[model samples]
Target: MKIAKLSLLFLFLGSFLFAQNQKFTIAEAVNGLRSNLAVKNISQFSWADDGKSYYQSAKNAYMVTDLASHKGDTLVSLYQLNKNLDLDKKLKTFPRITFITKDKGYFTQDSNYFWVERSGKDWKVRDWINIDKEAENIEMLSDNEGFVYTVKNNLYLNRNGKIVAITDDSEENIVNGQAVHQREFGIEKGIFISPDNSKIAFYRMDQTMVGDYPIIDWSVVPAVNKNIKYPMAGTPSHHVTLGVYDIKSNTKRFLNIEGDPEQYLTAITWSPDSKSIFVGVLNRDQNDMKMNQYNALSGNFIKKLFEEQSDKYVEPQHPLLFFPNSNTDFIWQSQRTGYNHLFHYNVDKGLVAQLTKGDWVVTEVLGFNEKKKEIYYVSTQVSPLERHLYKVDWTNFKTQRLAQGVGMHTGILSKDGSQLYDFYSNATTPRVVNVINTNTLKTRNILSAENPLKNYDRPEIKNVTLKADDGTPLYGKIILPTDFDANKKYPVIVYLYNGPHAQLVTDSFPASGNLWYEFMAQKGYIVFTMDGRGSSNRGLKFEQAIFRHAGETEMKDQLQGVAYLKSLPYVDADRLGIHGWSYGGFMTTSFMLKHPDVFKVAVAGGPVIDWNMYEIMYTERYMDSPQNNPEGYKQANLLDKVQNLKGHLLMIHGAQDNVVVWQHSMNFLKAAVDHGVQMDYFVYPGHEHNVLGKDRVHLMQKVTDYFDEYLKK
Candidate 1:
């Protein structure tokens, strides 16, 4: 149970440096220096409208490829693209280009927009649009004539040559064209444009009644207090309403959605004709949901098409997907049968048929074919630990697996559903890219990447399967220390994020799936990771098992990992340590304090001390309000168990973190002080939520130092 590869370190200075330069050190891995060692990918690839050709930015130029010949040519030279936009051609880098049709493509150089056309065989370029100023969320209309964007927190519509202000409110509480509900329920942008580009729909949120949490900017001489509108659980949340604007008449009307304004309006969708809009309305309690229809032109409430209810919560993350040719028929995803599956529905007949019924989850729905008879998706049907691409027929629910691989896979289909670009990766493989003919299923390897870490002294990684206390199977991975000795004992570190929408252990890349894990093993420590209940990609029961309980059930499942670790003969039980961020941070802190004697040291970053202090949308959906489920809230609250802490614990947070908030760990420190307990604490100045980019190297170094001091020594 050791690293199978030979060490490349030289004989004299053998401890740190490798001979030729293949040392998997922390500085290179965390400072983003090792990114060049990763498998090269054909970035920004786009399928053409013809379904037999594609455009890709590869080898420093945009290349067009024909499927039959398996050959490519330069679509636009970097020099030509830069010269056409009247820019300096200093660095030959390809711009972000997207295909509009078989022969037409659009790209941006600075604020200037350019359109390149495949005139016969040579590319003809012309200036398209000049963005006069900086804007956010710049989304072009379908006709490519105009776009909707945000400037200074207000919505604006630019059609032809005229720029019109869609909203004029100046208050911070009245924000427009930004994500609402704290980015929950899959609401990314607030603006929506109609099919004909004559009307626009946007969200108007009034956070005037919500509380403003103070966030200090420590970079200033005297830290300034910046208040952000944060609605905690059982608190007064913000109210949101949708408004439609008519560009020709310069008129606006609000949709008459009948509900409490604090309730959630999620998964917004428009009909193909743009005459009607569909919205999923969930109450503040999050137990009941109704798919309601509204008239787009008059901004009138139509009728409720269907409803879904659960004792815990019903989350809607996807919009109604209409067929390519039919305006009335659409597909909807639901977990009403204890599993997430797709169902075909008609506007008039309600449920047409259950299209996809399985014990697995459909992770994503790519799109439908041109004929509206088949759909492409990524699902967990092959295995819970692996994702595979598939196409399911709408008529009979016949499924065909695409992009042959044993691990995670994703693919993009052509507009006519003739060509598919399959990109996949697995445990032993670094990366694999393939092109498959959709009709014949004939495949060709475009790029079979070699293992980049082949020369490094890598640790052996093995996936382990165990069972929970409830007889449910659990998936995990164990990484043995590099240059391990069977006769000697080693301290183990359990890294996890066992929460909803978070799955730590997967069947992708090097088995361990994280460089930090391998680095820890190289430092003479075993690393373990597992996805307990309440994690994602399993069926509904696995994901919802921890509802209203939060950390309770996950702890039960994670303890199973601890039991397995303890049973190992070479594992040092007295020196077990744990580390995690966000929810995993919550788990790390909870495991140390709640169990007291199970682990020796723990490092938690941006953890949840009390569930009541969390946001309204995410917290209430899982744990319910403190008023509704007081016992569950009290059980999961870490502040209650601070007196039981018996290990070397370290807590870290960003000074300006607003997601989990700085107050969470700060309050935990206060609780420890009041209970006459001592724990280590650190803060990153001017950082929010997680320390990212180059600063993350510092964060990981601190984490590694704590484990070394408490466990290794």
Candidate 2:
């Protein structure tokens, strides 16, 4: 008995020592999740038009699986595709195929679009169209008769093998078929095809009036100056207008929008009959919006359907979603009730009904079940950190949860809205895919990804909830160092981004938070991240709390997190460090200067030192114009607060950054010199707002080295 017990003890100790033998390299800590340590997932998973089967892409084949039989078959292979095309060069891998019908799909290869159809036992290419090699922002017609694309500053349409120039602007400042307003207000693409595919509406932005800012390319021997149009707050902004091109007549006309030329036009949509177009016209102040319709062919203004007004700011991010079969009524997402919810409206009746209501917000609208008169959506009704699918009866406004699991659930609905391809992940679950029946709420697990970090020694992460100054609940996470000792105190680093439209903490996979945090924890440091006021996923009140004063409330809430850390027995309050990028970079710099005594070390990258130099659309909405809100701008400006710095500060910026511009930190250095303040500065050449790619490992290593040199000492 004694001999057996000794052997068991030896085996246990060997396992424990083996687990502690592994450590993360800087490269693995930075890019491991995206490369070698990436979790398995279904590639190009989508449902067929019949709603009875789904498809996924494999090594060199397209696979289709029947729902009832749970059996899969090869729909097409790279060999079969190349055999049908008879091309000079064969494809090395299967292209991304998107199905428009049950047995028909299309794929693009070398600027050529091929439509493939499945016969009894083989797949064949039915048609093919070749486009320009330099084409961008390509949008194909619904019937596949033609497509539209942009080349440089002009727009072109290829219809029935004929290329037609839609716009012929001589100057480059007049960009056609491109996103304007710096891609604000949820405008991603530039071209919008009509329902009948007979006409196309595109944005024409004239940026000649905007000021020119140079982004120097320092990679060459003689640096080249690349000037970009940058409109500062309260400055001359770009003028954008929409133009409709009729494919049949080969003619175009600009919309007759009766407003200031600089006003924003968003939420663009088309009528079912293709005779009218809808646009949400917002003024320069961004306080009010009018949903108006226009005649498609003549560009004549029709009646205004409705108007929405807000005291803070009216941000319309989503276009009107018309009912599946009805054109007169549609669903509009609004935050009027403090949370984002859906409201039904009619063109003539104005207000129809409020479909979903709660303290939580609806994140997305999946689809509609026309036969059952039900609408499918994903919402935060369970928790702010979790998203689940829900179905609601439009007639009675009764709602029911259809998705299982307590995590971030995202799904794609079939054409008939009967099956949902649900995908989700949580702290304990790496990934889980399910096919859920909407009516019966029956779920079948398709894929449950294994944890990629099972062999590594991970740190312990616990959710931390604290109260704001107003007693509002603020969520965060505290990552304890590996082999933590409660009796021994350790240095702490706070990584935060407390900016608008960003949330740092969530109940997702790799629950130890960012691997970099875990990487630091293994090196004997604790890491903490919190989402304070001005962060997204909360209600409008939570986000707008920092309005007019960008840094005041956010700092206060972050202090709450600081206080919580100081309360812990294992935290060394005197050795606190902080790091962030972009707006978070702005916050990190603000904290170092404004509250210098709080942190011992700080690293800020691509930070905005002055609000006045930021863009007009985003800055004016939060701080108003620099002219109107001079006091707010003066207080938030970090350049004036440079002399207050007392900690070891390292400021970094990208040489080619156009978003925040390099002038922000350069001017701050000028102020630092005048005040006789000592600080460190670094620059990454030939990079943008963020340092990406393999160089990201070097960036994070530099940040880590800075923290280790200052805080660990």
| Among all candidates shown, the one with the greatest TM-score | 2
Question: How close is every model to the real structure, measured as TM-score?
Answer: 0.95, 0.97
**Tens digit per residue, CA lDDT, model 1, 480-599:** 998789888999999989988888777787677788888889899999999999998887789888888888889999999999999999899998999989999999999988898999
Candidate 2's error at 293, in angstroms? 1.0
Best by lDDT: 2
| Candidate 2 local lDDT, 138-257, one digit each (tens) | 999999788999999999999878899999999999999998888888889889999999999999999999999999999997989999999999899999999999999999999999
List clashing residue pairs in candidate 2: none
Candidate 2, residue 349: lDDT: 92
- Show where candidate 1 strays beyond 4 Å: 1-22, 31-34, 83-93, 117-127, 132-134
Evaluate model 1: give its TM-score. 0.95
At residue 199, give the lDDT of candidate 2. 95
